[model samples]
Target: MTRAIALHQVSKAYGRAPRAVDNLSLSIAPGEFVVLLGPSGCGKSTVLRMIAGLEEVTEGELLLDGEPANHMPPSERGMAMVFQNFALYPSMTNRANIGFPLKLENPRQDHSERVESTARMLGIESVLDRYPAQLSGGERQRVAMGRAISRRPSAFLMDEPLSNLDAKLRNHLRAEIAQLTAELGVTTVYVTHDQAEAMSLGHRVAVMRGGVLQQVSAPREVYALPENVFVAAFIGTPRINLLRAVVHAPLDGRMSIDLGRQRLPLPEPLSAEHQLLRIQQGRDLIVGLRSEAVRIAPPSHARPGEVALSGVVEHVEYQGHEALVHLNTGSQPAVVPELESARPQQAARRRRRAGGGGTGVGVLERLRERATGHVGGPVVSLDEPVSGRQDPHSPDRPGLMAGDLVVRTGPDMRLRRGGQVPLLVDLEHLYVFDQQGRRICPLPRDVPGLDV
Candidate 1:
């Protein structure tokens, strides 16, 4: 039978430095598959290691099947782990490697039957005699998984086991792994930076950033209703289009979003949710529009939930299946920093708050203070609240002055680079985040199978 795992406010750290895995708390139901997903150094691996008892928990508790397992050793956790680098025995043949754990437990017992069964299950029966060095990367990965499955562990912890493989092989193995875990009816916690892998392989995904849990919910819920700006921007492909916008709410007129040179009038008799935008009037907030949320259309074809706008086509990219059209709208595009830098910044903030000290912390603070403001002049930075009227049309804003809005469209929609094009923004699908990177537009929780 499978086991339920619960991490209650768990945190891990090396020395007294900031927590590697912050006060993270999550529950995985018995036999359910959960993916811990984020960019590199986001503490996904650390969380997995702590669950596996491979790393010590600096604070809080870990419960396995309603029993505290904080002090348990890795071998006693009733779990099997598949590492990213394929931690197979280099000198051993596939057959021996697959049955290594079983043999270690019962030295005299012949585990050939069990080993062969797992080999066949994983479609690796032909490579049983080959050593790790002689096997291909995919073959080696299967052998490693075979070893883990042969033990009949209660839970499986896979840490980006397919990261080293090519795209084709990763896709193949991803399906195989998902099927195998379901068939075995074992609870699983998988870790990966690839959102595709996380969304496709798990029943739910837990997104992490800077060692802190961002959002944990079903894949569709996380994608469709991201809890914050980071989740919204991180989950989508071609990235979600973000812009600095101001809310326009008149006493008697319908509410709208002011984009400097253009405006989107929200649907009238606004639903309770859209009405919440009124309180944000005249305040600069970030607006997010998924490529699919906007489409090329004329005013006559515009529907109730969609608003129209015009822009100059900057470029067109043919992506085989569809085309990506870049437009120059008179607004500032919001830029999200790479997680590589975010990791350090988050750690520094945690240190400063905790009154800790280190060379890394000091250096980070110095860099933050020395960083220049927005564009040509000492104007409001992207990190700061970008009021709509503050230098609206100025070309001085460094990263994105004239908003480079990219819209996903069908291949048949062709246009010249400088041609004018009309587009529609789906009001129902619009996302809003505050200056602090927290979601604001989606005030109510409407996602299914989610209580947070």
Candidate 2:
């Protein structure tokens, strides 16, 4: 029988170290596949461990099948876990390893038939008699999965199960795991830092940062309507182009976003999303555009909902199917510090330095401010050099700076470096985030009463 899992303001901590899993609340329906995605140290694995009864919930509740299960023993949770390291017994044969759990659960009965069936299901039957040290990485992982499958648990908790395999094998096994889980129809919660894996395998993806849940929704919705700057910057390939912009809305003039050297004029009869920008007049904001949101074309070729902007080609990354063109538009890029990982102590030191004699704020409060874009100073140009530091975006060519915006185009479009190109921005796809990093444009249908 499949199981439902729910966490209500659940948190985990070890003494005074900042909460590893903050007040996170999530629900996973029976037979649904939900992926907990985040960078290392974001507490995704901690959440999975708590659900598996391997870690204690420091605060709040963990419910299994609508029943309170905070104090349940690991074995009594009715869940099986597949770990990252392919936890297997090196001394025992694969067959014995797969059968060990079943043997413990029922010592008098022979479990050979069930073990063989599980091995065959995972296509690891041929390697059953070999020791784990004698098998390949993929084969060993299959053995680990075989062990989990033999138990027929109601829920499957996987913590980067395929992370140890090669890229090709990981892709192959990813598909296999998806198929296997669907057939079993068991509730599954997977944890991984890879966005590609999360987008592909999960029925819904839950993004986490600094031990707090960022956003959770279907893959497409998460990609198309990211709730904040971090989500917008995290889920896409080549990364979204995030530029520092100032909204200029005059009583009788066109509303536009000023991007240092260029301005994006909002077309007349402003869209509801753009209308919301009226409240942001003269305010600094972050503008996001996915590479696909802009195309390399002249102003005359602009389609409906398109605006014009020009850029100088700074770099080109040619992939097989398409090319990513980086352009220097003299626009500033917003930096979301420590987007890949969280280092608390280093962050604390940086905070102390920025606070100019330790502004009495605590770490968690500072993290919340950083997440909301409140603590960081105004947008700074990464292309410029600081007084004592070397320029991070030093020009490859003398006097020519690197690009701040990346646009995807057909691979056939060959363009030379330093060439000026006209681009069309689809206003409908434009994203705007306030100084607090909250999405302001493309406002929700039922707008919240909170002030921006």
The prediction achieving the highest TM-score against the true structure is 2
Least accurate 10 contiguous residues by lDDT in model 2: 374-383
| lDDT for each residue of candidate 1 in 315-423, tens digit (9 for 90 to 100) | 7889998998887777677666543246756675776756636668666765564452111111122654335433423456333233368899999887986567888
Residue ranges of candidate 1 with Cα displaced over 4 Å? 339-381, 384-403, 448-452
Q: Each prediction's Cα lDDT score?
A: 0.84, 0.86
**What's the number of clashes in each of the models?**
0, 1
Can you list the residue pairs that collide in candidate 1? none
lDDT per residue, candidate 2, 1-452, as tens digits? Answer: 99999999998989977688889999999999999998788899999999999899999999998999999999998889999999998999999999999999999999999998999899988889999999999999999999999999999999999898999999999999999999999999999989989998999999987788889988887888888887888889988898889999999788899988789999999877788898888887889999999999999999999999988888999998999999988787776654633575467557666775544565555665455432222222223322332222345535556588999999999899888899999998899998867888777543333122
Q: What TM-score would every model get versus the actual structure?
A: 0.87, 0.89
